[model samples]
Target: MSFINFEILATSIVILCRVVIISLERLFPYNAHQSLLRKGFWNDLGMYTLVQSFVLSQIIFGFAYWLDGITELSSYGLLSSWPIWGQVLLSLVVHDFYIYWFHRWQHHNRYLWRTHEAHHSTEDVDWLSGPRSHSLEILINQTVEFAPLILLGCAPETIAIKGMLDAVWGMYIHSNINIRSGVLQYVINGPEMHRWHHAIDHEAHNMNFGTKFAIWDWIFGTAFFPSGRKPVGYGLGDENFPENYFKQHAWAFRRFRKK
Candidate 1:
C-alpha cells in the first residue's frame, strides 16, 4: 500500500516536471527547426500515458515484487545499514550499469534491435520520446532493472526516489530544449549526448548508451559528441516504420515476414 502511494507521488512529480520542461521548451527551444509536435507525437504520447498511468505501472511493479518474492530478498546487512540517500544513489549506479549494457545489446543484437527499433523510428526525438517504447521493451526493462534493485536490497522509498529521478531524467535527456550543459554533459547524461544516440547516421547512432550518467559511455568508449552541431535528425531510414502506436509496437517483427 505504501509502495503504491510512493509510485503515485513520485510519478505525479515526474509528470509535473514534464509539464515544466515542455513549457520551457516552447518558450526557448534548442532548435527552431523542430516543431512542438515533431513527427509521431501522438504515438509517443499514447505510450507515455499508458506507462505513466497506474494500470500499467501497477502491473509492472506487481511483477517486480513477485520476482523479488521468488528470490526472497529484502534490505540486508551493509545495504540496510546505509542511509536512505546512499541506498538510492547506489541503486541508481547499479541499475544504470545494467541498463547501459542492456541498451547496448538491443542495438547490437538483431532480435533485440527489433524490439527497440520502434523507439528509433521517430524522426523527432524529444521529452516524450523516452516512453515511446514497445510493450516487450518495457517489460524486459522493468524486470531487468527491478531485479537488481531487489537483489541489492534497496528500500521501497529508495526505489521510488530512483524511479522518480529516472522518469524525470529520462525525459530531460531526450528533450529538445536548448540546454548546453558544457562540461557537465561529460559527468551526467544530457540531451546533447542523447540526441546523438538517436542519430540516423551509423557512426553517431552506436554511441552514448548511458541512461543517467555518461561515465559508463566514457568507460566503454561509446560516447560521441560532435562540436557545433546536433544530429541531422532521427529515425531508422525506413519509411514503413509506421506512425501509429499499435503498429510501431509490432514493427520489429515485419523483418521476419516471408515474402
Candidate 2:
C-alpha cells in the first residue's frame, strides 16, 4: 500500500478508537473536571495537530526518501518477508522502547525540557492534550524514532500501523476520562497512570516517563504508583510562560538567556 493510503487508514482507525474511548468515559463515572477544552488547549491542539502534522510529515517523508538513496532502508521489503502479525508485534515493542528513552531524555535534559514543557503547560489533561507538543520537539522526536524503523527495513504499512496504535494510545492515556485497570496499572501506561505523570508535584512530574509500556519506568526506577492519592495540580510550577502558541515556540529558544 502507498503512504497516502496507509495514512488515511491509520488515521481513521485512531479516530474511531478515540470516539469509542470518549463514549465509554462518559458512561462510566470518574474525574471529568480536568478537560482540554479549557484555556490554551485548543490553541496548542490546532497548531500541533492541524498545522504541525502537515509540515512535519512532509519534512520527515522527504528526509526519509533522501536517506533511502544512501542506505538500504526501505519500508517495503521488511513487511514482505515476515508474517504480518509478527511484524506488528515487533514494531510495537521496539517503538515503545525507543519512545521510552526519548521521553525520559526530554524531561532530564534542560534543552529538550524547554521544548517539551509546552505539553505540560496545560493545567488540564484530556484526549486533545496529547497533541499539545512543541513543533521542534515533534520534529526531533519523530525523526529519531522513525530512523530506527526505517533502517530496520520495516514496511511502510507496518510503520503506519504502529504509528496509529501509538496515536490512539497517546490520546487515550492523556484524556480526562478516568478509567481504572486495578493491578494492570502497574504494567501498562493508562489514563490513571499517565495523569499522575503530568501532576505539578515534583515527584509526579518526574516519574512515569514511559509512553506505552510501564516496563521501562519500572526498569529505570522512574515509575511511581501511589495507592490512593491523585495529583493535587497539573503543569509547571514556577515557569512564567506565555499562553500564545507562537510565544511558546519562541520561549523554547529563550531558555539560553537563563544560563
Candidate 3:
C-alpha cells in the first residue's frame, strides 16, 4: 500500500483506540473522580496533541528523508529481507529498551528533566494526557524512533505500523482505566505501574521508567507497585506549572532556581 494510505489507516486506528480507551475509563476508572474534560483539557488536546503532533511528524520525516539523502543508507536495504512483522517488532523492542534507559536518565539529570517536566506537569493524566508533552521532548523522541526505520531500509509501511503501536501503547499506559493485568503487568507496562510514575508522592519519584514493556523496570529495580493503594495526586505538585501550551513550552527554559 502507498504511504498515504498506510498513514490514513494508522491514524484511524489511533482514533478508534482512543475512543475505546475512553469508554473503558468511564466503566472502570482508576481515579473515578477524574473528569474527561479535566483542567487544561483543550490546551492538551488541541495544542499539544493535535497541532504539535502534526508539525513534529512532518519535521521528523523531513529529517529522516534528509539523513537518507546524505548517507544513502536505504540503498543498502539492511532490513529489507525481514518480514514486515519482524521489522515492526524489532523497532518496538529496540526503541522501548533505548527509551527505558533514556527515560530513567531524564528523571535523574536536572538539565534533561527540564525538557521532560512538562509531561509530568499534568494534574490529570488520561489518554489525552499522554500527548501533552513538550515539543522538544516529542521532537527528540520521535526523531530517535523513526530515523532508524527509514535509514535501515524498512518498508515505508513499517513506519506507520510502528507509529500506531506507539500511539496506542502510550495512551494505554497513561489511561485512567483501573486495569487488572495481574501477571501480564510483570511483562507489559500499563497504567497500573505508569500512573504512579506521575504521582506527586515522594516515594514514586524516578520509578516505573519503562514505556511499552515493564521488564526494564523489573530488571533494573526501578519498579514501584504498591498494591491496594493509589497515588494521592499527579503532576509536579507546584502551583506555578503553566496551563497554557506556549507557556508550558517556555517554562522548560527558565533558569534553575537557587535552592
Candidate 4:
C-alpha cells in the first residue's frame, strides 16, 4: 500500500482502538469512580494529544530528513530488502527496548525527570493520561524513534504502522479498564502493570517501566506486580502541579529545589 493509504488505515485503526478502549473502560473499569471528563481532560486531549503531536511530528520528521540528507543513509536501503512485516517487527522490538531503558532512566535521573514529570502529573490515570507527556520528552523519544526508520531505509509505511502500534499500545496500557493478563502480563504489558507505574504508592515507585513489553521489567528485577491490591493513588505527589498546557510545559523548566 502507498504511504497515504497506510496513513489512512492507521488513522482508522487508532480511532477504532480509542472507541473500543473507552467502551471497555466503561464496562470494566479498574477505577470505577474516575469520570470520562476528569480534571485536565480538555487540556490533554485538545492541546497535548492533538496539537502538540501534530506540530512535533513535523519537527521530528524534518530533523530526521535533515540527518538522512547529511548521511545519505536511505540510499543504501539497509532495511528495505527485508519484508515489510519484518521491518515493522524489528522496529517495534528495537525501539521498545530503547524506550524501556530510557523510561527507567527518566524515573531515576533528576534532570531527565524534569522532562518526564508532566507525564506523571495526572491524578487520573486513563487512556488520555498516556499522551500527557512533556513536549521535550516526546521530541527526544520520537526523534530517536522515527529517525532510525528513515536512516535505515525502512519502508515508509512502516513508520505509520509503528506509530499506530505505539498509540494503541500506549492507550491500552494506560486505560482504566481492569485487565487480568495473568501469565500474559509476564510478557506483554497492560493496564495491570502500567497504571502502577503512575501510582503514587511507595512500593510501585520506579517500577514497571516497560512500554510495550513487560519482559524488560521482569528481566531487570524492577517488576512490582502485587496481587489482591490496587494503588492507593496516582500522579506525582505534588498537589501544586500546574493545570494549564503552557504552564505545564514551563513547569518542567523551573529550578529544582536544593537539598
Candidate 5:
C-alpha cells in the first residue's frame, strides 16, 4: 500500500475504535447514567477530531516529507528489516516512552505549559477532549515526539504505524467511559489514570503526564493514586479563558508576554 493509503487506513481504524468503544460504553451503561451517549457528544467528537486531526496531519506530514529527504528516512524501511509485528511493538514502546517525558516537559516548562493549558481547559473528559489542543501546541508536541523515531532510523511506515497506535490509545484513555482496568492502570495509562490527570485538583494538575504508559510516571515518582477517590472535577483553576479556540490560542501568548 502507498504511504497515503496506509495513513488513511490507520486513521480510519483509530476513529472506528474510538467510536465503537465509546458507543458501547454508552449503550451498555457500566456506570448507571450512560453519560457517554448524551446529546452533543458526537458533535463534539466530529468537530474536535476533524478540525484538529486535519490540521495536525497536514503539518506533521509536511515535516515528515522534509525529514525523509535530509535523512532518506522511511519508517517502512526500518520495519521491513525486522519481523512485521516486532517492528510495530518496538515502535509503540519507544514512542510511548518518548511521549512520557515530552509530556512532562510541557508541564515543567512555563512556555510550553502555556500552549498545553488549552487542553486542560475543558471542564469535562470525553473522547473528543483528546483532540481539543492548540494547533501550535499540537505541532510542537507531535514534532518533538516523532523526532526520536526519525533520528533512530525508523522507516516512515513504522513511524506512521506508531502514530496510529498513539492516536487510538490517546483517544481511548481520554474517553468518558467508566471502564476500569484495575492493576493494569499502573502499567499502562488507561481512562481511570488519565481522567485523574485531567482532574481539577491541584495535586492532580501536573501528575500522570505520560501519554500511553504509566511506567515512566512510576519510575519518576510523579505518579499519584488516592484510594477510593476520583477527581472531584476537571480543568484548570483561576485562569478562566474564553472557549473560542482562537481566543484560547491567543490567551496562551498573552500569558507568555506577561511572564
Candidate 6:
C-alpha cells in the first residue's frame, strides 16, 4: 500500500477511536468531571485536523526522502536486516530514546519550554489534547521520531505499522476514560503514569518524559508515579497562556500581551 493509503487507514482508525472513546468517556470516566465538550475542544480539534492532514504528512515524507538521499541508509545499523518486527522494536527504542532527551529539555530549558508550553497549557488531558501542540514542536518531534527509522533502513511497512501503533498509543495515553494497564504500566505508557507527568504539582514536574516506554524514565531516575493519587490539575499555572490557537501559536514570540 502507498503512504496515502496508510494515512487514510490511520485517519479512519483515529476517527473511529475518537467516537468510541468519547462515547465511553461520557458514560464512564476516570474523573467524574470529564465532559464531552470540555475546555479547548475547538482548539484541540484544529490541532488534530492539522496534524492528520495530508499536508503535514507530505512535508514529513519530503524531508525523509531528502535525508535518505544524502545519508543513503546502509546495511549497518543494528536493526538494518533483522525482521520487520525486530526493526520496528529497535526503531521504537531508538526513536523514543531520542525524544526522551528532547522532551526533557523542553521542560528544563527556558526557550524550548516556551515553544512547548502550548501543549502543557492544556488543563485537560484527552485524546485531542495529544495533538494540541505548537506546530514547530510537532515538526521537531516528527523529525526525531522518524529520522532514526529512515536512517536505519527500516522497511516502509514497518514504519507505517509503527506510526499507527504510536498514534493509537498516544490517543490511549491521553484519553480521559482511563484504566490501569497492570504490570504493562511498567512497559507501555498509559494514562495512569502519563497524568502524573502533566501534574501541576512540583514532584511530578520534569519527570516521566517517555513517549512510549517507561524504561527511559526508570533508567534516568526521572520517573514520578505516586500511587493512589491523580494529578488534581495540569498546566504551568500561567494564566497568561492564550486559549485560542492563533494566540497560542504567537505566544512564544509575543512577549507583550496586548491589552
Error of 5 at 137 (Å): 2.4
Name model 5 segments beyond 4 Å from true. Answer: 1-8, 27-47, 73-80, 147-157, 256-259
Instruction: Quote the positional error of residue 65 for candidate 1 in Å.
Output: 2.2
For residue 173, give model 3's deviation from the true position in Å. 0.5
Alpha carbon lDDT at 206, candidate 6: 88
Candidate 2 deviant stretches above 4 angstroms:
1-7, 75-80, 255-259
lDDT by residue (tens digit), candidate 1, 35-103: 877777765675555643345567777877787678666635336677879988777787789889999
Tell me how candidate 4 scores on lDDT.
Answer: 0.94
Model 3 misplacement above 4 A: none
Model 2 clash count equals: 2
* Alpha-carbon RMSD, each predicted model: 2.7, 2.5, 1.0, 0.8, 3.4, 3.3
TM values, all candidates: 0.88, 0.88, 0.98, 0.98, 0.82, 0.86
Candidate 4: worst-modelled 10 consecutive residues by lDDT: 1-10
Query: Which candidate tops lDDT?
Result: 4
Error of 5 at 150 (Å): 5.3
lDDT (C-alpha) at residue 209 in model 3:
98
Q: Model 5, range 1-259, lDDT digits (tens) per residue? A: 8889987888799878977977865764333443654433553456556776777877876786688778775544654567546776776677678777777888899888887887887766777678777777778767766665665555567777877776788777777776767888788887777888888887887888777888788889888877677777777764567666667668887834544
Q: What TM-score does structure 1 among the candidates reach?
A: 0.88
Clash counts for the predictions, in order: 0, 2, 0, 0, 9, 0
lDDT of model 1 at position 80: 64
Better of 4 and 6 by lDDT: 4
- Model 3 reaches what TM-score against the true structure? 0.98
Clashing residue pairs found in predicted model 2: 75-155, 126-175
TM-score for model 6? 0.86
lDDT of 6 by residue, 79-139 (tens): 6667978887877788788888999999898789877888888887777677777777877
What is the C-alpha local distance difference test score of each model?
0.79, 0.77, 0.92, 0.94, 0.73, 0.77
